[model samples]
Each structure stands twice: as structure tokens, then as C-alpha cells.
Target: MMKIVADENIPLLHNFFSDIGPIETFPGRELNAQNVGDADILLVRSVTNVDEGLLKNSNVKFVGTCTIGMDHIDTEYLQQNNIAFASAPGCNATSVVEYVVSALSSLTESNGLNLEKIRVGVVGCGNVGSRVVETLKRLGIDVCCNDPLIDQTGLVSFDEILSCDVITLHTPLTKDGPYPTHHMFNDEVLSRLKEEQILINTGRGAVVDGRALKHKLQKQPSFTAVLDVWESEPAIDIELANLVTIGTPHIAGYSLDGKVAGTEMIYQAMCRHFGLPSRHKAAQFIPSPPLSKLYFTSEAELSWSMHTAIRACYDVRHDHYALMSSLSGTEVQRSQAFDQLRKSYRPRREFSTIKVLLKNTDSSMHSQFKALGFNVKSA
Candidate 1:
């Protein structure tokens, strides 16, 4: 049997990979060359940095991360060493989208902003950004996208993105090239953001200059910032944390379905690398969701009903509150608490897990709910 060293936080490991090997679980941060030296396969999450130091002397031939981002992995070294690598791209796309929706819903409710009237600018129209655009459009909201990597015929420019009523970033972290995303929203861009705009960053933390953002927030204090990913995370800026509208511990993609799907994707990749059949399936290992169904009466407002169902599946406020409360401690303690929060994050199901019953659903309402990934049933 292949020896597989994996991050303990990865869910449903035994259910999906027990037959393939003898698995050793280690805290992602604690995984090192010493523990991984004997393994033929290595699995990790974003917390575990897979680089030359960790893999130079290890026998591990395959590496997989159960997260969407690849910034944590040293792909060049893996390629040079001929070690196979795989990452679950778009696995958590829906999870992140649901997070954005929930956050926006809460924000609009608290501020009494009309959801349909607000214009949203989505940066990085990849898996997550595209889904966000689709969701917003389905709800009859005005949305514009900006992605330099792809065709920009109908898309807006970065300058235009900054001027929108709300801006959400989903780009990967890249430091080099013609259009680098490192501090993409620096002082210049952030300075242009007006008081009415809501800024959200669920992408890489460094994509926005945290110091610049802090300065902007302190000086202006106009825009609402919702940040899930932060620069210098764990040891993130506590003062800045207090300033944002919502600050979460990078748990936007921590939904149960997304995490399980990530594991399954990597398992399949490893099987292909080893020339073995992938018999394990995500559905087989998934447990019943805590919230199975929700009912909405005909008299209920469509927006209210949708928000209720979305929150029923996953509420961003719980995560926001948890992160905010963790700041009431020493800096080191806050950092430790941040990591602990992620380690012990409660399982959250995606919107797809719940069935929505509408007492009087119109065609438009049904289409909207379906687009939002809910199972809608009409009374």
C-alpha cells in the first residue's frame, strides 16, 4: 500500500482513500521533511507550505492540496523533480460564492441598500468570479467584470471596477508579469473608492495592500470592507480587523461540500498518477446536511425568502463574529486563535444542500432560486 502523509484537517480522508494506502495525519503547519520523508504521497491544505525545504529530502513523489489556491505550492520544484502535483481548482467556487452572497445580503439588510439597485464589480472572472457574476445577474443586480487575462470586450477596466457600488476580488496572488495582482488595489486604487462603495476580498490577502487599505479606512472611514483573506494572515493586522465590516479567518471556502469535493478531486488525481481506478466518490462519503429543507410562504418577500434560505445553509456573520471576538487578546494569542478557528471550523453546507419550498413561486422566482443553486419546489 502507498504511504500517504496528509493534513489532519482534510475531511473524509479515510472514507475516500483508505483502500489506496496507509495514511498518516499531521497538523498542516507541523508537516515537515522529517514526517514526510517516508511517504510516497503527500497531501495538504493551504496552511502547509510545500517547497524545496519540505520535499528536497523526502521520498514523496506526489503532492496534492485540498484547496483552490496554488500559492502555497512550489509547482516549479515539483515539475523539476518530476513529482506529480494536483490542486482542486473550482472545488470551492460555489462555497466562496455563497459566502459573498451571504455577506452582501447581510450588508444590504443592515444598511437598507436595495439589493437589485446596487452595482457590483467583480475582479478576476475565473471560477469564483464568474459564478459571482452569474449569481448577481440572476438576482437582477447590475454587475460588471474585469479580467486582464481573458477577453475584455464587455468587461470594465480596473479603474471602472473601483468606482462601482461594491467590489469583490477573486483573483489569484501573482507578483510578476505585465498585470501583477500583488497589491493590485494599492493606495492609488483604494484612494479612488468612494464612501458608498463596499469592498470585499475573498481572494489572496496580498492582492490588496493591507497597510494601504488600513490607511484608507482610517483616514476616510467611508467604504465598507468585507475581508475573508488577509495579508500576513494569522498574524494579520488586528487594528485593521476591527475596521472592516466583516473579517473572517479565510473560511469562505470551508463549506463541507467544498472541502469534501476538494479531497475527492485530489484522490482522483493521485489515482490517475498511480494508474489506479478511482472508485471513491464524494457523494458516498457526504453525510446528510444539518439543514435539509426550508419553507417560504406566499406572503414572504422574495428577497427575504432567498436571504433566509441562503443563511440557513451558511451564515457569514457567525464566522465574522468568531474572528472579531478572537481579536480581544494579545497579538500572538490572536494569531493562534485565528489558526485554531480554521482548524476547528464548524462544517458549513453549500446552498445546494437545502430544498426550498415556495408557496407561490413565479417563473422568475423559480429561475432565480435555481440559478442560486437551490432545489426549489412550488406549492
Candidate 2:
């Protein structure tokens, strides 16, 4: 029998991968060589760092992270050691997109900004950014995209990206490259942002210089910042958190539907790595959301109705509150609570799980809702 070691936070590990071996679970950040020494397989989320220090003496032959970003893992080392590795790309793309929609709804509702009227600038047109562009356009919001790697029409320059009414980041964190994303939005970049513009970063914390962001926000109270990810997380910048319009622990992609999809993706890869039959699927283990279908009355205005429906499915404020409430005490305590927030994050279902029942809404709304990833029908 194979020996497996996995992160305790990975949902449905036993249901999906138990047949392969007996599994041991540990906190992802605390996983050390002693814990994984004899294991043949290791599974993780983004928190665990799979490098030589932890796996140097281990019998672990296969490694997997159930996350879209692989910045935590040392891939070159894995290749040098002949260890097979896999990451679930685009697994939580929809979850992140829905999180954006919910955040946008909150902004539009509170700030009296018309969703259809404002332009949204999306930096990095990867899995999440591309989906964001598609969804925003579906809602009739003008979208400007920027990704240097891809050749596409209508891709905006970095300067144009700064001019949008709302700018959302979805790029991966990179330190060294021709276009390293590390601190892409630094003091100089943050200074150029309009005071009335909205800046949201769900992609990576280091993508924006947190200190610069804090100074900018302090200088301009009207500049709205909605941060889902942060620099030096768990022990995040307290002053910055206190200053931002909305800040939360990185749970944007922690929706139950997305988490399970990540588990299943790595499971399939593990099965292939070990030459075992891949019999399990993600849908088998998913449960229904509390509100399966939500109906909007005919009197419901388009923007208000859309915001109401989206928030009803997944409200971003609760997440913001959860993080703000938990962040207190010493640095270590705040860090621990940050991890705890992620571990005990309230179960969030993706928009695809709930059907939006539109009545009194324009027939065009059906395609719009569908474009936003919700199953829609006439009520």
C-alpha cells in the first residue's frame, strides 16, 4: 500500500484518494521532513513549500498542489530529483471570478457606481483575468485587458490599464523574468492611480507594494481598495487593513466547489503517476448550496437586482468582516488567526451552483447571467 501525506485543509481527501493509501494530515505550513519522510505521495495547497529541506530525505516520489499558483513549490528541484509533480491549473478560476463579481456588486451598491457605466481594467489576462473580462463584458461593462505574453486584439498598455474606473489584478507572482510581476504596482505606480478609482488585488499580495498602497490610501481617502490577498499575510499590515475600503484574508478561491475541483484534479494526476485507476470525480462529493435558486421580482431594477442576486449567493463583506475581526493581538497571533480564517473559512458555493430566476428582467439578462457563470431561467 502507498503511504500518503497531505495538508489537513484539503477537502475530501479520504473520499477521493483513500483507496490509494493510508493518509496522514498536517498543517500545510508546518509540514516538515520528519512528517513526510516515509511517504510515497504528498499533497498540498499553496501554503506548503515543497523544497529540498522538506523532501530531501523523504521517499516521496510524487507531489501535488491543489492550487492554481505554484509559487510555493520549487519545481526545478522536483525535476532534478526525478519527483513527479502536478498543479491544478484553472481549478478555482470561476470561484475567483465570482468573488470579483461579488466585490464589484458591493462597490456598485455602496458607492452608487453604475456597474454598466464604469470601465474595469483587468491586468494579466490569464485564467482568472480572461474569465473576468468575459463576465464583465457579459454584464455590458467595458473591459480593458493587459497581458504581454498573449497576442490578442484590444489588449491595453499598462498606462491605459491605470486609467480605468476599476482596476483588478489577476496575475501570478514572479520575481525574476523579463516581466517579473513582483511589486508590479510599486510606489511610482500607486502614485499615478486616481483618487476616485477602485483597485482590487485578488491575484497576489506582493504584486502591489503594500506600504505604497497604504501611503496612497492614507493620502486619498476617496481611493477605494479591495484587497483579498496581502503581502506578509496572516501577519498582514494592520494599518493597511484598517485603512482600506475592504480587506480580507485570501479566501477568494476558497469556495467549496472550487476547493473540491482542486482536490479532484490532483487526485487524477496522482492516479496516473502511480498507474492506478482514476475512478473518482469532483461532482460526486459536492453538496447543494443553502439557497439553490433565488428569484428576482419584476420590479427589481437591473443593477440592483443583479447586485442583490450576486450578493445573496456570495457576499464579500462577510469575508472582510471575518478577517478584520480576527486580526488582533501579537504578530504571531494575527498570523495564526489568518491561517485559521482560511482553514475555517465559511463554506462558499460558486455562482454556477445557484440558478438565478429572472422575472420582469430584460430577456437579454438571461445571457448576461449565464455569462457571469450562473445558471439562469425565467421565473
Candidate 3:
């Protein structure tokens, strides 16, 4: 059997790759050359930094990250060493989209704001942002999209995005190149935000300056912020976490479906690299969700019913609560707790997993629910 070293948090690894390999699991951050020395396959998440130093002495012929972002992986080193690398792009996109929707529903409900009335600005129009734009428009939300890489007609400028009622970021973290996203939202951009405007960051933490955000929240009381990914993640800024309206430990793309999809993506890639027949599928390992279906009453309001169904499958508040409880120790302890929380995160199902049966609802209502990614059916 092939020798494989993989990150421990990657779900269903053995189920997918066991027939081909003997897998040894390690914490992503702690996965060093020593752990990968004798392995022909190395799999990791965004936490592990793949570089020459780590792989120069190892037998790792293939490297894969089960996450969308590639900033953590050194593609140059892999190219130079002839080590094949694969990353699961858009694997967890729907999960992130659902996270934003849940946060939107939860935030709007708490703040007494109407979802359809608000204009949301999505910074990146890639896999995740595109889905967000489509979903929001399905709900009749006014949306503005900005992507430096893509030149589409509907794309708006970043300045235009600044004026939106809610700004959701989905850009990747890049330091070099023409369009750098590191510290994209500094004091100047943050100062432009209004007191009541909502800011949600599920893209990357450093995309918005943490210190600047903290200062902004401190000086401006009512400026609402929702953060899932932080700048110096694991070792995140606790003060900033406390200031945000909702804080989750980089789990926006952590739905069980998403993670499994990611694993399957890389598994297929590895199989292709080795010229092996792919025998396993992700759906085979996935079972029915705990929340199978939801019933709507004749008296249920459209918006209220939508929010109820969304929250029943996923509530950002639950993640926020879990994260808040882990924030009580020293910086080191808190940092460790943050990573632990992500590793042992509860299995969250996607919006599509929950079946919504509508009663006495219009066609538009059913269509909207489907657009929002729920498995909707007329009762």
C-alpha cells in the first residue's frame, strides 16, 4: 500500500484513501519534515506551510491542501522540486455562502433591519462571492460586486462597495502582485464606514486591518462587524473578537459537506496524479442529516419563514457562543483553544440539507427558499 501522511482534521480520509494507502495523521501545523520523511503522499489544510525546508528531506511526492486558499502553500517550491500539488478550490464555497446568509438573517433579526431593503457589497466575485451575489439577488437584495481580476459588466468599484449597507468580503489574502489584499481595509477605509453599517469578513482576517478595526469599533460604538477569519488566526486578537457582533473560529467553510467535498477533490487529484482508478465517492460516506425536513404553517410570514428555516439548519450564534467560551485563557491558551475549536468543530449541515415544505405560501416564496439553497417543496 502507498504511504500517506495527512492532516488529522480532514474528514473521511481513511474511507476515501484507505484502499490505496496506509494513512498517518498529524496536526497540520505540527506536520514537519520528520513526519513526512518516509511518506509518498502529504495532505494538509491551510494551517501547514509547505516549503523547501520541510520537504527538502522528505519523500513526499504529492502535496494537497483540502482548503480553498493557497497562501499557506509555497507553489514555487513545489514546482522547483517537481512535487505535484493540488488544492480544492470552491470546495467549501456554498458553506461560506450559507454562513453569510445565516449571519445576515441573524444580524438583521437582531438589528430590526430588512434583508431585501439593504444593499450588500461583495468585494470578490470568485467562487464564493459569485454564489453570494446570486443568492442575495434571489432574495431581491440590491448587490454590488467588485473584482479586480474579472472585468464583468455588473462589477462595481471598491468605492461603490463602500457605500453599501452591508459589506461582505470574499477576497483571497495576497501580499504581492498588482492587487494586494493585505490590510485592504485600513484606518482610512474603515473611517469611511457609517455607525450603523454592517461589515462581515469571511474571506481573510488581514484583508481588514485588525488593529484598525479594533480602533474603529472602540471609537465608533454602533458599527457592526462579523468576523469568521482573523489576521493572525489561532493567535487572534481577543479584543477584536469581543468587539465584533459575531466571531467564529474560521469555520465559515467548515460544514461537514464542504470538508468532505474538499477531501474528495484532493483524493481524485491524487488518484489522477498516480494514474489510479477512482473507486470511492463522497456521497457514499455521508449519511442523512439530523435535521431532515421543516414544516411551515399557513400563517408563517415569508421573510420570517425563510429566516427560521435558515437558522434551523445553521445559526452563526451557535458558533459564536462556542468561540466566546474558548476566549477565557491566556494568549497562548486562547490561541490553542481557537485551533482546537476548529479541529473539533461540530458537524454542521448545509442549507441544501434541510427540506422546506411550504404550506399556504406563494410560488415566489418557494422559489426564494430554493434560491437561498434550501431543498424546498410545496406541501
Q: For candidate 2, what is the lDDT?
A: 0.90
Identify the runs in model 2 with alpha carbons over 4 angstroms from their true place: none
Name the top TM-score candidate.
3
Residue 308 of model 3, lDDT score: 84
The predictions' CA RMSDs to the true structure, in order, are 1.2, 1.2, 1.0
Clashes of each: 0, 0, 0
Instruction: Write model 3 residue lDDT over 127-246, tens digit each, in one string.
Output: 999989998898889998999899789898899999999999999999999999999999999999999899999998899999999999999867899999998888998898898889
**The 10-residue segment with the lowest total lDDT in model 1:** 359-368
Which residue pairs collide, candidate 3? Answer: none
User: What lDDT is reached at residue 31 by model 3?
Assistant: 90
The CA lDDT at 367 in model 3 is 86
Give model 2's clash tally.
Answer: 0
- Could you estimate the TM-score for every candidate? 0.97, 0.97, 0.98
